[model samples]
Target: MAGLQRELTLRFLAEPADVNFGGKVHGGAVMKWIDLAGYACAAAWSGKYCITAYAGGIRFVQPIHVGNIVEVSAKVIYTGRSSMHLGVDVKAGDPKESTRSLTTHCVLVMVAVDSNGKPTEIPEWVPTSEIDIEMRDSAIRLMDMRKKIGAEMEAHIHP
Candidate 1:
């Protein structure tokens, strides 16, 4: 199956209510938007309900101010038997401005689920474009790093 639909972009205006005491948009708010965009992309690709299994490397590069126009983009970069890995990027800038700066980025792992909440396999996605291939390869490399990190973390925990 063609997987070109496994990408999504969402845009919203950051209002006063979205800002913290510092007058910058809250990190949690941006994270919520990221999750929503990732979920939408995964669901569209899998054609099934999905749940976020993990979110890694969340980096807030810049603060998003109130009244800034926010854009969240999510794309499927890799997939397992039942899980889809997504790369999400968030950007914000003045609505009238021609340029937007990246505010945050993260990778999310989402697993397709059935009505019983059990993980289910979805169609495999093969990268057709040069950019898609590059992204998929990057995701594979990151997944290897994630595994090593998880192993180290587990070794230190004695629970």
Candidate 2:
């Protein structure tokens, strides 16, 4: 696996439409944001269009309540021939109350595919800074989590 500093970070103001009956942002909505950020990070890192091949280890660590501003950050961690590992984290804050917490975190695996939907080689990952090391470690851990979850999912399907 290689490394790249490509990332996408976005801030969104939580609204009623983003939350559920429990008054927290819907898990699916969080996942949608993760997917978008992950894919965009991968595409930017590889300089090619990318599609998500898998999502795993999606954990809701805290609840993002309505009226909070949520910040999402994502980046590419690992790259194979045509595949990448992405990490996404969601944090919630209030402009007035000064509260910030990690609401969710997820691991995304994406593949670079050509116009014909065939997998294509990714660009070379060049890491020249300390931040790259942290990203590499994060990617490794995220990949391990993905593998474990994938195994469990497979067992559920096959068993």
Candidate 3:
């Protein structure tokens, strides 16, 4: 069997259609791109259809202007019985500039599914490098944090 792919990177040029009334790339548009990149990375790793089960800690640190070069990178940091935890980072800068600042960062959980849309088991991923091991550990830590946050949210009554 071929080794599982753990990372994917996608680049796009920000256009007028992606901008908001503030004249910067819209948050919704960036989110859509994030999901697409995460899905692509998960599907390729699992060799099956995948869906976004959860996306958390999405933070737009800086604005991306129209005409900037945007790069979305997704890396599979951890895996479970049927899910993969991905760390996605979005960065953008002017084409003529040499530096790109981080625009957004998020963690996405993607689950593999079968034809009927039921979750299916995927090949187990083992960390082969020091960086991969550290990433996996970080994913585990984040998972714990997510559970705690979710519990807190569930306890709060909504209007």
Candidate 4:
């Protein structure tokens, strides 16, 4: 791994179709982009076809306007058997400057399945550097948050 590989990058110019009446990009549009980017990242790392099994915390802190271009990037965080966690970051940029500001971040858990739709094992994640370690740690925290959120939802829905 001398050459660091980019998993997936999607640039979307905030269009009227992709925005709300307020002229800001719709949350769902951002989700669609994140889903594609995350799936691609997981598939590249797993070296197999993948499906998103779960979506973690997605916070849209700032509104991206119609003229701004949003770019999404992702990388694999952890893997266990058929499950892989992919970290995604979304940034808003201006055409004048390719530089982007991080606007959203989340973790997506995906599963690799076989032709029969059964879960399939994938290569384990290996942290080669400090950045890798931080990625894994962040994934772990996100995973725990997902569990907590599930518990909260269950308390409201089932209890």
Task: Residues 1-159, candidate 2: write the lDDT tens digits.
Answer: 223447879887888998888878898888988888887788878877889998887899988888888888987766778998777898888957676789998878899988998999987565557887787777777677767987999988999
What tens digits encode model 4's per-residue C-alpha lDDT throughout 1-159? 211343678877877788787878888888998999987787777777789899877878788878898889988777777888888899997968968898888888989888888888887777878998888888888778888988999989988
> Looking at candidate 3, what is the lDDT of residue 107?
93
lDDT of 1 at 91: 92
Worst 10 residues of 3 by lDDT: 1-10
Which regions in candidate 4 have their CA more than 4 angstroms from the true location?
A: 1-6
- The full ranking of all candidates by TM-score, starting with the best, is 1, 3, 4, 2
Clashes (N, CA, C under 3 Å) per candidate: 0, 0, 0, 0
TM-score for candidate 1, residues paired by index? 0.93
Look at candidate 1 and give me any clashing residue pairs: none
TM-score of each: 0.93, 0.80, 0.91, 0.86
Model 1 gets an lDDT of: 0.92
lDDT of 3 by residue, 54-149 (tens): 999899999999999999999988999899999999999998987889999999999999999999998888888999899899999989998998
Candidate 2 clashing pairs, residues 3+ apart or interchain: none
Q: Which ranges in model 2 have alpha carbons more than 4 Å from their true place?
A: 1-5, 97-99, 127-131, 134-159
Compared with the true structure, all predictions reach lDDT values of 0.92, 0.81, 0.92, 0.81
Model 3 segments more than 4 A misplaced: 1-3, 157-159
The most accurate candidate by TM-score is 1
